[model samples]
Target: APDSGGGSSEDSFTEDSSTDVATEDASTLIPPPQLGLYGTLNQLQVDVSRLPRPDEYNPAMSSVEDFQTIDIPSDIKTVAYYLQAAQILPPGEDEIRFSRQEDQLAGGLVRRELDRSIARYAAESGDTATLTMTGEVLAPEVTSLEFYYFDGLAWVTQWDSEMLKGLPQAVRVVITIRPARSANRPEMIGLTNSMTAIEQGDLVYSLVVQLPLAEPPETMGDSAMEAMGL
Candidate 1:
């Protein structure tokens, strides 16, 4: 659909309003929207982001702390091709997708693109040169972000429609923001645990998104059919 803008982004994944998520329940909280997710390119700021075009799932989760590159499955069995620029855009045009760091070579350009993406986010929220450490600026104030998939059973750390043979029944994401560290008390911060973040005055937001469980469309590509063992 659309991509997150450098420096101007803030965990705009689907858009959430309240920054103080500690009071919000565990349910996936919906934001009011700032960046247009679909084809709302060219605008640095939007009061609310538009929804993705039906049949288009090029998803990205850019926000305050982490900026990952876009990952669109090539031979997916479930999702209908979720990537950008080369696939989503008209031939020869480039586009940004919401994402994070590491394994950036998504859709063949994940790592490099994500580096640039995170660089943009880090420049605004944090700093790209700094690792996930205390005092190291991540995106704005966001220090870490993570995504999970629920396949009607247990929660998983990662999800690939190609491997699962269908879309996830629900998705869970955790975004951690480092509250301004105290000048008098400087400490090291690592992006490995949410509880640790909470103990250190960091704000951790958890969102569980439930998706409709629909049968795959009848129009399956040969690769998708093969992956599904059709």
Candidate 2:
């Protein structure tokens, strides 16, 4: 599936859009409906890998600094295999069978790739990276599972899957990032959350990852040698 370029749009997750969240004052004035117990997964693993390297180095674009992993809580039982774009039914549309063919409203629909230029650069450089997640579901009958990305302001659903057989199932999700070719060093720090629905409540798991810029190596200079008293 093609990637959604990096930019702010009406449906984009932005800082200004986050202000629309439900506030305590507003909630007190009008109590919100109970949406079951809201919980989060205990643990999640993030693996980032570099594709291949190009013959020529481009300092203008962002490179794969490193791959970092996050260990979260393991209370909720669920697993995600691959992470990518998914199609969901449009608002106001009636939900059908849990099967992908039956329920998917569209496909190749993703909020945004982590670093747009990464993929482009990787492809051009003949090197790329991928992100995948796996977990288990503890609930007896899990109705559905949804994955989202936080773009500074809000969480946007990137993949949604309906578990037809329900519960004690394994989940997998995947997404790929290539080397960035642009000079624009956009912030790669972001948060990802997953919502799993069960009979009791929803399990919401959040993980944070920051793609730092590669630090340049320091070359020996006369000032450095003097400071060291060499």
CA lDDT, every prediction? 0.33, 0.23
Q: Which stretches of candidate 2 lie over 4 Å from their true place?
A: 1-80, 83-145, 159-204, 213-230
What is the alpha-carbon lDDT of model 1 when measured against the actual structure? 0.33
Clashes of each: 24, 39
Give one digit per residue, the lDDT tens place, for model 2 in 1-230: 32232322112222222212111110111111221111112112222234423521332332212211112222221222222222333476333222223212222112212232332333344322122111111221211223233222233333121211111112122121223325754312111222101111223222233223212124535653342222
What TM-score number comes out for model 1? 0.35
lDDT of 1 by residue, 127-166 (tens): 3222121111213344444455544544445454444555
Off by over 4 Å in 1: 1-139, 184-190, 213-230
Identify the leading candidate in terms of lDDT.
Answer: 1
Q: For model 1, what is the error of residue 183's alpha carbon versus the real structure, in angstroms, after optimal superposition?
A: 1.6
